[model samples]
Target chain A: MKRLVQALRNVERHYLLLLAPLLVFVVAIAIYPLLFSVSISFFKYRLTDPTQTKTFLGLANYITAFQDEQVRKALANTLVFVFGTVTTELTVGLGLALLLSAETRLMQFIRSWLLMPMAIPPLVVGLVWRSLYNVDFGVIPYYLKLLGFDLGRGPLGESATAMAAVILVDLWEWSPLLMVIFLAGLKSLPSEPYEAARVDGANRWQRFIHITLPLLQPVFLVGLLLRTMQSFKVFDIIYATTAGGPGTTTTVLNYHIYTVGMTFFNMGYAAALANILLVVVAILSILYVMVLEQRQL
Target chain B: MHRKSSRLAFLALLMILALLATQCAAPPAQQPAAPAAPAGEEASQAPAAAEKPFAGTELVLASMTDQYVAAFQYLIPLFEEETGIKVTLDPLGYVDLYQKLTADFVGHTGNYDLMTVDIVWTGEYAANGYTLPLDDFMERDKDQLALDDIMPVSWTLGEWEGKHWAYPLAGYANVLNYRKDVFAEKGLEPPKTQEQLLEYAKMLNDPENDFYGIALLGAKGPAVAQDYMVFVQQHGSSILDENGKPAINTPKNVEILEFFGKLFDYAPPGATDYWWDQRETAFRSGKVAMMEGWSIARAGYENPEISSVVGKVDIALAPVAEGMEPKYGFGGWGIGINADSENAEAAWEFIKWLTSPEIQKEWIRHDGAPIRRSTLEDPELNQEYPWFPVLLESFEKGDGDYRPRIPEYSIIQDALGTTVNAYLVGEMTAQEALDQAQAQVEAALK
Candidate 1:
């Protein structure tokens, strides 16, 4: 027993040695910058200043962020985008996974084909959609005009429709990912539950409602968390399509942070805003972990 | 249990890193996939290899993907042959070029040895010392540069507070381009004043037939802001007060904003989102009766491949507000050496060679804008481009400071970009828009 324990300890030490490089990589790229961002949030710094001066202004940047109307509007916009994309993606993705989960050859081919959009870069997707949405010389507008829909300023050029248009683009690109995830969940679900439900005189609809959904709770949680996080960070789509235009209707939190950091070069305020976003994401992640832990129990 | 817990922690760490990457990894502006290779293989056959003082020095030029980029492509090979200095051209879009150059400057990367500086960036570049001041180079090369031959107004390309931060490379004058056939059919002359221009637009607008009165840039951000400033310049109103403070929300400017909005009534339904490219498209495709734009595009309107209205377009001086002095808008690119560049002399030599009067003619032929008075008056160029006379007149009376080339210009631009767009899209009234802009600019300045 003593010899076995010594061998196990040696194995564990080797495992730690292997993990050290990854840990160092993570610290350099992720943890260090995160800490730096948190530290800078309390200062007043402009990247464009020749002297690269930093004056301490503890909590002033955060206070200004709360009071700034642009920040508030961007936060609201981001929340709306997150909610819109996540819920719609989950529902549509669930439907697609169910319908396409059959093991037939055609079904497999169609499933692979549907995932094509996910393979293309989001920037390219946004640019292609932007052209399709153009008012004068675009296919969508031409067809919409024929169908008798009065599209004022087309879809992306109007304040009322811009956010919805952006959401639709995200849905087109990302719903396939959720579909694939839910499909894996569906495949792994035990057949015993459905068989028992049917044996108790449960119909297909009833079986799905009572057994499938209940069993898929963990998968739903995972999909929701993953998509909600991603939707909060939407930038490339808005940048390519609307550029937060038509009177700042589509500007999200990330894009606003970009404007501050990159455009204005107000690094301190941008860092504060980024930290706020990080905290929001962290809270969501913690809630996710707690729920996941309870489910395992 | 310990292994499982460690695995979970690792997964959590990965998630956070993924999120951080999204925030930090700013998408690098798309650069040309391949840098140009040096084409000077005949270095040994040169008049004298000893005379090539900067031979084998490599320079990278970051240029806006404007029409003049074609000129760069055409001229660089010849420059490489003559001076034995190899130049790699990196063409980028407008926003990308600005952001990339700023990042390079701020990081002191010394990535681009030379870059094309926009007129509006002069004050910012000078204030930050991002570019080497060219006054010394100009003085040393005064004999070769033909300093007096360059148009006086063109000096604004990179001049700030009596110092030259960049040498004038291309000069563009704002001029009116209208369909001659359409004007004749309507029996109307070119509008000579702002009021007459509006009246003509109203008369020419035929939306039912998929045609519009004029193509104007109404898109948010720099597009609309610059277009509105063009009208403000025409009205003889300044973006700055007499004391050189931002006076964008003045009563006179508010009236000008309303006038600008009114003109949009006759524009295309989708004009609200048109960028410079789209506006150019609308005019080139013959869907618009008139357009007020840079003289650089005038030649493109005659090219059959790109223009639908070839041989049917006419040029006129951009109309000014009635009773206002006729000061046209002048703006274009200036080539500047990066302050951190190690090959500053070689880069300056390239600039001298590119802007020489002899090469300026070839540059003009290949879609480059003219900065030299001699190039504008060259008999061959005059014969080739019939619109040179109007351009010369407009450049002589150009107002390069209309857009306010101050260090804080971008701040004002962003404010006006949002609010003017807000006003145009009916989210805010003209008064409220300008007022908000004023507040934003004031806050930023503080």
Candidate 2:
């Protein structure tokens, strides 16, 4: 105890040594900017005119963001996107993991190759898909025609199909993460339960459900939690593909904030919108953690 | 003893070389060492001349990535020789340029010494004092700027309360662009009036054949505004009334809205989504027979590299409305001085030389837009770039002087954009959407 106290005293003596770099970093990047943003959020900051008087209406900016139709649509779109992508990715990813676990060497090679999709930058993937979905020259329409489908070209960025298409891109890019987690979970599963089930003359399906899912519960929770967080923040691919276009059909919440904050320079309103986004993400994160904790209990 | 003396000599030589190296490297790190100057005792020192010679300084200028590179690498080398200043241009996309300039001004950093700002930013920027008033520069060198040279409207965007703040750099406005071959094939001359345009659009509508009569920009933000201006101006409907209230919901505007809505019947399938580049691409790819677009597309239309329909494109005056005057679309570019700049005089000289009629003619000759009135009408210059003279002639009928130049213009435009978008997407009836947007604009003003 005395030695520990001395060590603490020594650390305190060199506290500047410990804190100087961190203080410099945080103050430079995170802490100062956050305070600055919070300050600006109270004032109406216009990009073209900084000298323009900012209205100090408390909560008015929040009210504006909440009342905006575009904001409402974007929020709904964001929820749909997060829910749709996260759910579909987990199911398909777990299935692929189970299937791949059957074969060893071949599956290893295939697993490595399949992850190249994730390795590709989202922008390049979007560009590649844009070309493949082009009305004039895309491969999908050509193949569809070959298969006797008269479906015209230009399907990716039109109507509600665009929302589904961008979601599919997210699924393709991120589902590998789910597969990796499940693969680790499957490999770490104990053999005793399966042996006991075999001794009891239990079938593969019954044993699998009772054993595999329960055992992989922690991994599944982690994957879903991580993915739900990321899904709520999807912006770049959507921007590169459609620019929230065809009359704001595919505009998501993040893109809305970008256009509002950066494009229009409505700093106060944008900050309000950002705070709402932060709240949503925080709630989703806590819900995931609590749900998993409850299941554990 | 002799070997010891040789070692002593070697040590002495090494010490001298090290001292020389340290002294030589000190100036670069210690002072604003101008790269254009040779290494000397005076090289690292700031200029002493009160004439404000630009010879030993470096400036960063911002422009579009495409032809602006040519302007920097090719056109400015002679300027470097004449002025002794190193000009480095940072070229970016048009949208990127807007965002960057907006951010730079808002951040109060003013990192850019000069930037080619869009005309829309002028009024808003000037109102806020983000840009420098060009009065001092003009007064200092009255004869040099030849301030009366450029066209009046082009020059006016840079003005705030009778003070010139920015130089009118280049003029780029959309006119009616059509495929001559397509018009000939349909046995239809280019549409002379709004009703004729609708008829022509219907005649050329052949979606089954993978072609559409008319293509247009209907995307959100500035896209919808650009397309709507020609129509609204054609009907003599103003965005702001005499009392500074929203006048966009007037009967004239309603007729214009109805006319555009009817145009939807013959428009491309996803016409509501097409922006500037997409509309141009559609026309170039032979997918659309006609598009009401800008003079910026003129050079692209003539270039075989960018367009497949080269030599097949023609420009026309914007179609006239029945009850209103014919109006040409307003799209111009401008340059300005930073009010807080330390080297205001040098910046002024650059502006004057750049916008001079002699240079504008050279710019027009080399894949750049022209802003000068005389250059547009110059016989030889006109013959080379045929669109220049035609564009000037079209401007004669131009009572359509439209662009949201006020500080609240962006707010009004956003409301207008949403209204048009809602109406077109069947989200709201045309009248309802227009009324709502007008109400929104009214509230915004308050």
Candidate 3:
């Protein structure tokens, strides 16, 4: 009993022992699922069939994914969504952050109100936007017609515009997160460089280009990495609104994975698709981290 | 200082343990007091109720959120009163219910004692041993249940591999719902043939007035697949050939697809994006003159809150091919005991009580879809639901198994749904889409 108490005392005194529970939790929840998913990707398993055992297929699932046209289309759509939402969000978010940089009463109020859209759950955002895009009773289409815009079955109903409509919903829900990040970045920026630029006869635009943007490179990379990763995994909005409809124009990679895994019960193939998504996200994250590190140096 | 900090840490741990102990002890005291009085009263009145074979047993039911399930909640208290079994109802959305049920069954968690199974899932569930056969239970309680009173079509829903896996709860017959007023003005009879229906559609189509002739399901996934099956069956073609092989690209199927494409021109402009709710909304909002809908939605057409076409609509069996006999689509839910359930006997008792003829009669009064032939024939029920007779006729003639009940139905649905949607959106011709679907479905089946 004395020896047991001494061992306990030693662990308590280490301080790092306090983190053991959290470490175990992370390993159990995160690392285990990741490893399990990777292992499942190497098999041919269908959840629906009880008689069939999981057959080991090596990299056959991955090879099939590369050859699958639907998967390729979904990958292309995912890239388009990530590029479209990230670029537009960064541009608009930077502008809003710049405008709200002024320390004033109304700007403060507007800054707080900008976060309302972000507060809404993504599924609810999808549902609300779906109603707003409805052709018959939707407020947007009604007013667009009144304003003489030829919508032609509304944006979501047409193959040509469904992707754009979905991107717009993502923009509405997520742009505010970028704006908040950029606002903090702008405030934390050194004013000494701007003062020096002005002394050198640099105008506001020149100062912003040379001084502000250079200083904000790390922040920009962080925002890009976060938004890019999120946009690639887009599912709930497409699910609630378009359901990958209008000829599969809005079927992003995550939605495709869901359909393969849940809808079709192709668990092994779905795991392969998921691992591919993880690789893409990891590469993007590493690239962003490298750029940020370079900027820090 | 080190000694004092260690003492503080020890005291905090003691406090947390004490708090948890208090919480663990609280529930039992609160639970027993509420049921004691009624239990005592019932004990004196009915010895069986007092003895309670399954007393303290709790049964959890996973169900899809429907009007019937909502009304069924009232009976839970009575069940608890008589059987001394606590019932927990977990109602989820249709898709979510299937996913949850699948996960629970696959994991063998025994989380759900009962599940409301879709008829289409009977084969998959039974083959996987996810559901228990109810034949033994039925035989034991034969006289009490009166299994013969259920509609024959309803009985077929529960039978897979020559055994009963579930008891029918709700049965729907797919019907063509049309604007009666529009048909009257055009001097049109409800068309009995697909060709006549298309001709009538062309005549009634008025885009300027925001009235489309038909509201076809063009949404990708199960919506389009289900709607397409109705047409495929009507054309005297099956998804699988006579040899039970993929025959989705048959000449008859191709003809139907081409005809469906032509019909799409007269449907609402965004019809390709519509699902079940959207299609029903199109009809109820008076945007479309006609649509193929299930019998379940017929009651909603007269509800003043959401419907603008009240008293202006009529129902009929879906039109068949020119020379073919008429057949309607059949679909609905059934309740089954989970094979992994620990309280199977208690769950079986609950199922018996829920499906009893007396409860079923009362059930229909509160928006429940009927599965019993006797309920449809009851004069009082007929007076309330005038469409019951038509529903019964459709039930007798309808083919419930039009959509294959195989384990591969989901994969087949995905392949065909995507192809059909592509054709509807003009991404491919009917032949190309059907060919592609045939190849994909055959590959999936293999």
Candidate 4:
């Protein structure tokens, strides 16, 4: 007992003790459910079944997912959403960061105000934008009508514009996050390189391309990876606004999983689809890390 | 060392998304358990009357926040005052109510002692035994229930294979609400046939003046799916064949789909995105000259606060196919006791009292829909509502099975929900859309 107490008193042992609660919490709250999801993905489990039967199907659910046309279309939509939102947010966020990099009270206030969109829930944002996009009563179409643009079906009503409209809502909500991240990167950037470039007769644009862009590559990677993962899991906004419509144009993978799991109560299939999404996200994340690391080297 | 740390960072990121993935895939565990009436107060204020047998027994009722929830808000307090059974009301929107009550049942949490079941969910709930089969209680109390007073079609709200999984709570019939003033100005009459409806819609539509012929439920999911099913009912086409197997891709259904899509030409451009509320807004705001909707909403048009077309609206039985027999689409809510609830007796007491003819009069006065013949024919209510005759006629000829209240009903709704909207948005041809919907439903059944 004395030896055990002595071992427990060791500094490394104390550190383990400090982390034990959080470790337990993470395992219980995160790891268990994940493992449970993986297990269920191999079964045929209909949540509404009175008997609560679990028929083991091995790889059948995943196989079925590949065969399902809805799954393929949803996957395509998710990729489009991730690609559209991340690229636009990165470009616009970078521009906004550059413009507001100066230390001024007014700029500071505007920066705070810009974050208001992020603070509101995505579902609320989608609903407010849905009304604003209404062709008959919405302000957007009304203004467009005044400008003599014939909006045959409003932005959210047409398949051609539905995906883009949802992407714009995502952009409006998340761009401020990227701007904050880039602003931090900009602030931390070494001033010595800019000074050296200025002494070498580099103009503002030239200095930006040569010095700023190169240094901000790491920050860009961070922003891109974060948004890409979040965009893959988009649900609330889609649930609130389009509900995968304008003919499945806005139906992303996450929303499809929701329909399968919650609406249809087909738990096994839903879990399989979610695992597929996770794998896709994981592979993309790995590729992003490798590419960024190679560039840095 | 750098490779190890980078891998660790990658694993950390995986954990974050893994958490989200599980949350996304799994049924939610959290119950939105509203705070119940304080147990301490219930004990202190327990009624002394011997009649209050279930006094101090608290129950939770999950209800859809349809207009009728107002009646619940008004009546629940009175019930508590008399019976002393404290009932907490949790009002949820349509989709949320369905999903939440479903989670409660599947998890066997009994978070809700009672819930309002949509007519379409009768099959699924009964098949799963999520709700108590109420036939036994009905048999025991038939004398007091005045079983004869309930209209025959109202039984469709909860009856499955001769068992009552729920008791009919609110009954609605599909009816057409047209602007009488506009119809008079155009020298037209209310449409009695589907062909006439289309003709009158086109004639009245004037987009240059920001007015359209009709407002519709065109957004995807249940809104568009149920609206389409209403037309299927009106046209005397069944989503299922005579054998009760899904046959959504029939040539007749395809033609109906095409005709349904054509109505969009005369609706507001954004009508293709309108859900129930937006469609109601279009009519109430005087932007549409006509809207075919539930009889439940007819009364709201005369309430000037939400409606600009007060006293200008008149309702008729929804139009049927030119030569088909007139059978209005019937749908509404049924109050069911959760099978897992420990307070089933108290819950049944509440239902009996609420649906009684005496209280049902107060129910309609406070915006509740009617299930009883006496309540629908009440002289005073007739004077107040005035549209009850049309509703009575529609109910007498109502067809509730038009949407197929089967265990696989949600699957059918979901399939049609997507494809119908897909057809409306020109993503797929009518034949292709129905074929896809049929394929989807068949696959789900497997």
Candidate 5:
């Protein structure tokens, strides 16, 4: 017994032993749910109906997902939301990062002030925007009316503008995060390259395009990856604001999964929908990593 | 070789520890039994004798954070004092409450001793055995409960398959609320027919001036479906036929949808995006001249702090189709004991005290919707809520089953809600939308 105890103590001296708890936790919480969801995706399961046996349907659920018109629409909307929020955020974030990059007191103050929206919770942002877009008493519509914009029943009330309105909320809440990341990326860029570019008579736009942007590719990739994934899974803001309303224009894939899983209790179909989303996100992530790796090379 | 064996042993130890920890953290296999009333206790015992039965017992009630729940909070102290039982109110939003209640019931967690059930959930909850049938308890205390005093329509909401699974707490009948001042100024009486409603709406609509004829629930999901049902039922149509088959694409339903589409023109620009709160806000803010809303919102209209149309608003039965009988929308919350609850008897005691006649009379003063016939007919309550008589009349004619109390109603509502919103927004014609909804609901039912 003493020999065994001594041997166990010696084995614990390895640093990998310290990681066992974290590894076990990840397996239990993360990997287990993922595996369970994947398995359930192959069955016809309804959580609310206890009498219905969880019959194995093989790939039928996945096939049904491909044929579902609502799923298709949700996928299209998710793509639009992801592309819309990420590109706009990048452009707006890059501009703000450049503007605030200068060493000045006002810039520092403005930088700090810009982060206020980021500090606010996303759900709270949705509620604030909902109030701001209220036609009867919202401050935004009141000003737009004063400015003669003919907002014709606030922005969120019209399908033509609801998706854009939701995207703008996402931009307001998340653009600051990207801006801070880009600012750090900018500060970390070697100053010698910018000085060399200026010596060669490069213009401000030219220097930004040639030196700053190329050097910031990795940070841009990280921002794109994070924002795309998060924007695809956006349920809170849409739930708070439109609830995917005005003719399902803003019903993204995650919202569809929620309606199916929670409202309808079609657990198998919801699982199938979830796994398809996982695949889409996984592919996007892999592409981002490959591009990042190539850029590093 | 020695190191590898020790490493394997250490890994095995870690696995055993994890399993042991999980087991330790799990809930006990059996819940503690509730304290029973003393044997040989006489039926004529004083109130204090009954109070000692459940002393020191705690119960958790899962409920929605609504005006009715606020009233419950106000009345809970009286119950605690009378029974000496501690009560914890777990208030959640409507959707959150449904999700949490289902999670607790599905897992048989017994985390909640009581739950607030929507009338529409009766079939689902009872069928799944999530809630305990209150018939035995009602039978045991029928005299004290005064079950017959509850309005038939209200009490019937708790009945499914000839079993009582819950007790009615609030009876909300959807009634038409109109601006009295505006109608008087325009020399128009409240519309009694569908055609007159449209005409009145057209006359009242002045969107350029931010005044709309009506406020419509255009938000996608249950709100739109519920609003559509109010129109559909008045037009002598139902989402499901007598045989429980999808009847949404019938001619009458189509006509109702077409008329509803036109009514949108007289509503606020984003009326299609409005929910209950938005519709109420629009009416209270005087943006809309009229709206069909639940009776619960009636009290809010009388509060000057949140309403600009307090003294200007009056309630009436929802406008009906010409030659059709008036049918109001019936919906509200019912309090039910969790079947897995260890403290069900104590929970029932709380429910009984909450719904008793004397407490219900006091509850109405705190903005609780009346479910009892006695409370509805009380002269003082009628004076305070001038619309009480109209509400009682509507309740007599109201049909809670209009939305289909079947377990499949949620899926049907989802299909109908999406399609109706699509039609209203011009994404599809009425025919196309109904056809699509019919197909979706049919597939869901299958």
Candidate 6:
């Protein structure tokens, strides 16, 4: 009981010491702005209006944003991009990680090289891909033409394929980070289970299916959750590549908030839109965590 | 196993050290160098400022023009030398400048001694006394400041509800861009009227072969709103009636919108996505034979790597619509002083040298877009750069053009863009699009 008391006192001291500074910082920078924005979302406020009062209009701004077709389109685009990129990246990244785990001498160097894209600024990566996707001067078209296919013009900014192109850029830039994490987990895995499976006369494929898959579940689920969250909040790549063009086909939820609030100076509407976006992301994150946790168990 | 654990610890330590290095190097690396020199005072002459009347005072003048940064920095030395006031120039882009100034107004900070404000932002800033009156500065320094020498209209853009808020700086307009080489190759002539321009666009287009006849802004924002206003004006319709009431939908306006909507057929495939740079890029790449854009694109077109028909590119007056009047775009910017300035007198001294006829002349030579009536009308100046004189003549003759002078202009523009882009992309008929936009704007206006 005396030991327990000392342990509790130690835990309490450390908690207060760490919690005070972190809470203060969070309240000033993150929580304060978040709450302030929520309050502002209920008003009719103009950034430039000096004398006009920010008249309280409960839920009017929220209703207007919800009814906006542009907002709906942006929300739809965001969902499509997040799901499309996250699933593909997770699968491809896991596949690459497994392939990389059985590698020979250059495996470490190859692993490091694969991380180059992640190291680059997302905006620069978007710009490089923008050039690669350009119809007239891009190498993407050249290679496709070599294989007898024409991808058409201005694909990144075009209405038919802009959202897809944004997803492609995000996948290209972030898939490597997923690979690194999975590879780390794969390298650290014990060999005893696999040896036991082999002793039971299990084939390579069966061993991988029965042992490897089940063992890698924790790492795989963690990767999925991280990728999904990151993909949902993707902005710099979309902004750089498309700026949401061709009748707003590429206007993701974040981009919509930016245009409506920052560009148009509709702070109240933007705040409402941001809140909706937060709710959406929060719901997706919850689902992601639950599924990952269930899979781990 | 012990070594492996130690290696993991080493790798973790390396990452920590890398992060620490990054955090240490980040701040000074990101802070934009506060404008390197004061406006209008040449930097080399700052040492001589100690002898002048304003010896001990400090002046900070801000302007928005990275394009003319080199030329503006030249004045820092001379102005500091003659005025005995240390001057600091805060240079930024149009959008950034607006946000900063607006935020300053809200905070009532005297951060900037002389601030660069969009002349139209004058009413709110000036009326609220966030900006200082320049009348006293002008009167006291008559020998240095020359208002009569500046373009009258460009100068008046600084005035709001009958108060002088800014001095004219750089002025240019969105004009019709046509390629002389393409016209000759295609055996077509420049359009004299808006109807003819549309017809020419149809003829010049060959989209299947990777060529667009023209490029136009289809997005909503300042850009689309500005272009829509110009298009409507060219066809003889005004967004705001002379009484300053919302008046966007009329028969003539509907016809104009329909004409532009149909013209979309000849524009680039993703033309609705293009902004000023994209339009310039498309035209420069020779993907489009003609485009309606800002007048200063003559400089961009001059670049050999970009333009497919640089040597063959030529300029002509924009095609007038059915009316004889040309619907010129409100496409220029001016400068103003912040009212909360502590060193207002010293800043005014620097502003004089920056906007004076002599400095304006030098700017014309350097900046490509200087705003002064004398610079615009000089025949000798026209003889050197042929486009300058022609643009000046057009600026002199241009009339009946305006932007949304209201603070709520951005909302109206958003409504305009949503409707215009929807129509251009074939979502709705021209009449329907205009009606929807008009309705949305009117509702927002209330």
Error of 5 at B293 (Å): 1.1
Fraction of the reference Cα-Cα interface contacts (below 8 Å) that each candidate reproduces: 0.39, 0.16, 0.40, 0.54, 0.47, 0.12
In the order shown, the candidates' DockQ scores are 0.30, 0.12, 0.29, 0.38, 0.40, 0.16
lDDT of 4 by residue, B248-358 (tens): 999999989888998889998998798999999999999998899988998899999999999899999899998898899999999999978878778989999999999
Model 4 clash count equals 0
How does candidate 6 score on lDDT? 0.69
TM-scores, each model vs. reference: 0.91, 0.85, 0.89, 0.92, 0.91, 0.82
Question: Which candidate has the top score in lDDT?
Answer: 4
Model 3 Cα lDDT, one tens digit per residue, A41-82: 998977776754688999999999999988999989988989
Which has the better DockQ: candidate 5, or candidate 6?
5
Where in model 4 is the C-alpha error above 4 Å?
A1-17, A284-297, B1-49
All candidates: CA RMSD (Å): 6.0, 11.0, 7.7, 5.6, 4.5, 8.2
**CAPRI-style grade of the A/B interface in model 5:** acceptable
Task: List the candidate 3 regions with Cα displacement exceeding 4 Å.
Answer: A1-16, A290-297, B1-52
Task: Please tell me how candidate 1 rates in CAPRI terms.
Answer: acceptable
Given the true complex, what DockQ would model 2 score?
0.12
TM-score of chain B of 1: 0.90
Expressed as tens digits, the lDDT of each residue in B1-446 for candidate 5 is: 86686677676555555565555544333322222332113233425455368888899999878788778788888889988989999999878988889888877789999988899898888777788888777767888988788988997567888888789988899888999999999888999987888899999999778899999898788888889988887777898888887788988789889999899989987677787788888899899898988888898888999999878999898888899877777888889988888777778889988999999988888878889999999998888888899989888888888878888778888998888998888788999988999999888777
Between candidates 2 and 5, the TM-score winner: 5
Task: Give the least accurate 10-residue stretch of model 6 chain B, judged by summed lDDT.
Answer: B27-36
- lDDT of each model, Cα atoms only? 0.88, 0.70, 0.82, 0.89, 0.84, 0.69
Instruction: Please write out the lDDT profile of model 3 over residues B217-269, one tens digit for every residue.
Output: 88888888888888888887898878666688988899988888888888887
Residue-by-residue lDDT tens digits, candidate 2, A132-223: 66554468766865687554314553554767877888888888888988998899899999999999998999888888899888888888
Number of the top DockQ candidate: 5
Chain A of candidate 6 gets a TM-score of 0.86
lDDT of 1 by residue, A88-207 (tens): 999999999999999999999999999999999999999999889988777899899999888888798888998999999999999999999899999999999888887899999998
